[model samples]
Target: MTDSVALWFRTYHTAPAPRLRLVCFPHAGGAPTAYWSWARELPEDIEVLSACYPGRQDRLGDPYAPSVHAMADEIAAALAVLAADGVPLALFGHSMGSVVAHEVTLRLGAEHGVRPVRLFVSGSEAPHRREREESAAADDADFLAELRQLGHSSLADMDPGLLELVLPSIRGDNGWD
Candidate 1:
């Protein structure tokens, strides 16, 4: 019965001299801080805005999306506000965020009439390419094992105590699907 809130995003102030902006979406169980270093690495002309979904880190009390669509909607709204300056945009997403970014890009194009100039997707394939299932609801042991198999640095390298601390929010959000 956890209440969900809007997703969070971080705007890294770049030179802002370019006509385009680049928005980055995080993978499942990821936070904005994951890409903090990316901002400094990107070209100065392409402003970088990294998305940080709720229910983790600073937003630990918020609820994560129960489905991919829900996650997309949350991201779209946040991006709408952050990218409202009318600059052309490009999207980059990895893993779970790739699908969310695709959905959001579609919504932004169809609903807001804001079409991104390009989409850079990694670590995930096209949406219709896979079956949708409640894979996250698998038992914790198996789920953790699966995450390990997926090569997530956070989960794989986490100390038991920190993993214990962070696991609930991940499990809660993952179980929703």
Candidate 2:
């Protein structure tokens, strides 16, 4: 994989000769590690590539993407390199990731002349139906409440320092400061 692609994608397993590549995008404040198990669960002929957004995990020092469209543009450029390899790609995304994946799909087709074979989205509204209004929690307490409501109670048990680091990405993903 090219260095540029490596910056945005993480591969947990190496497929000897992949028939297809499945690129996964995680939810808001999610990391590439979320899809790490897919490499073990799916057929060996399918390589799994997960998006590793900035400001988390290995890219912790990088700034969070200014917007989802910006994130998609960068991801599309990186995936275009993989598309050039002739292996068919299938995208899977959950929650906020679904929007980013949708944008990347459009970019790959329009800018790179690459069309993914399949696109699977979960837990997100239709791209065109998304509202532009702010949806982020109003404050730390509200953010924690939202996380709990979404079944992310585990985050509540996280180290305070770690939670502090994560909140920014979550808020950023939801289009708030």
Candidate 3:
């Protein structure tokens, strides 16, 4: 039997005999598609599982997670169920996802007694090095400008049609409002 929540994952390719599973957590305003190609790019020994948070893309009908911690806790539970036999697990995160991955790692260890083979963080600062960036407090234009300064021009110039589809999930990811 297969896990239902695990089925929610998106992968660009599949490896029938993967040595390990590399679970990817996406950045803010990100979706499972962000790492979909990894399923093909990585070696056959690695199975890339890209998580899709709810209220975005095909999962739009599902309720959004209230906070990063809540999201992490939930995913950790799913991972525990999916883990079996000798299949090793690892995590990778980018931007806001780094924080989510870190929290999930902690939760898996504390609550489920599961430990990932490794935790890889990218495009984000360490917990002690983080500060509340002011852009979240800024108005729309200012926020876009701030994001532009951070080299996220896509956020500043995204098509209105796409923005309408993703903005709410982005706001949920950032815990805005």
Candidate 4:
């Protein structure tokens, strides 16, 4: 709803005069489209912008983010434009997104002199404590198995064709051979 940099974000819905803007960061092995339903259901006073990562959906050909820090920095720059518009901003993230949101918040202050009013982080460790899960997939088969075990029934039910589409991004996120 703003400018050229909007390309990195997907707006499933928007408000003309929102009390606050919420940017949703997708989890690893996930994409912005998953948050599509949220835009329609949230309060009218809240605007929703789901950040879309590269190498997925409309950015199928685009390269995946090289690292979480790099991705967060890029997202911070995009959010800067929205901040400039005088809208109160907030970030909501789950799992990997939680960490990305934190990093983005920090970058916004240090790099852009902007700060979000609230940062809601869920399903993530504290900033001072970080731990790596042993999800290093040895192969595609292993990666798919991990997803199924992760209790994502959707992954268990995914069609092979669709699975093919999403697996690479997941693997890339996992950073395993």
Cα error of candidate 3 at position 176, Å: 6.1
lDDT of 3: 0.80
RMSD of each: 4.3, 1.9, 2.3, 2.2
Candidate 3 Cα outliers beyond 4 Å, as residue runs:
1-4, 134-139
Residue runs of model 4 more than 4 Å from their true location after superposition: 1-4
Question: For residues 46-153, could you state the per-residue lDDT of candidate 1 as single tens digits?
Answer: 777777776777777776667777777766766666557777889988887787789889988777777889999998868779556566435767888877776765
Instruction: Give a tens-digit lDDT track for model 4, residues 10-69.
Output: 887779888998999888778998788988888988988888888877888988888888
The residue ranges of model 1 lying beyond 4 angstroms of the native Cα positions read: 1-7, 16-18, 136-139, 152-157
Q: Worst ten-residue run, lDDT, model 1?
A: 1-10
How many backbone clashes does every candidate have? 0, 0, 0, 0
TM-score winner among the candidates?
2
TM per model? 0.83, 0.91, 0.88, 0.90
> Which ten-residue region of model 4 has the weakest summed lDDT?
1-10
The lDDT values for all models are 0.72, 0.89, 0.80, 0.84
Predicted candidate 2 versus true structure: per-residue lDDT over 1-177, tens digit per residue: 798799999999879889999999999999999999999999999999999999879999998898888888889999999888799999999998888889999999999999999999999889778776665567888878877987998987999998898888888787732
For candidate 4, the lDDT comes to 0.84
